[model samples]
Target: MTRLERKCPICGKPRAAEHTPFCSKRCRDRDLLQWLEDGYALPGPPSFPDNPQDD
Candidate 1:
């Protein structure tokens, strides 16, 4: 494998030039969907509003 070529992030198949890092459109779409659905999360402290809402 070349320096740029690697297994797909989602399926472990050889990645395609058209879809770098992913093997196919299906894998690419799956990754996007995961982002859209909040399936991927960044590690951080819980966020709170600057102004506390008094109930």
Candidate 2:
């Protein structure tokens, strides 16, 4: 029996041999581009004012 991991990091689909942790090359590339473009970000020091009215 082959173990299958049913989660793709890119599109959240079943994992495929062609893309390992991603569903397809397209999805994999999408994730890569997001990383390169700074689209994927982490919560850092608050840059916005605590109150919406302040802005």
* Candidate closest to the true structure, highest lDDT: 1
lDDT of 2: 0.82
List model 1 lDDT by residue over 1-55, tens digit each: 7746678989999888898788899999999999999999989865775667842
Number of the predicted model whose TM-score against the real structure is largest:
1
Stretches of model 1 off by over 4 angstroms after superposition: 1-5, 48-55
How would you encode candidate 2's per-residue C-alpha lDDT over 1-55 as one tens digit per residue?
Answer: 2449578876677888888878899998999999999898888877776897966
RMSD value for candidate 1:
3.4
Q: Go through the candidates in order and give the clash count of each.
A: 0, 0
Displacement of the residue 51 alpha carbon in candidate 2, Å: 27
* Model 2 ranges with Cα > 4 A deviation: 1-3, 42-55
Minimal lDDT window, size 10, model 1: 46-55
Give candidate 1's total backbone clashes. 0
lDDT values, one for every candidate: 0.87, 0.82
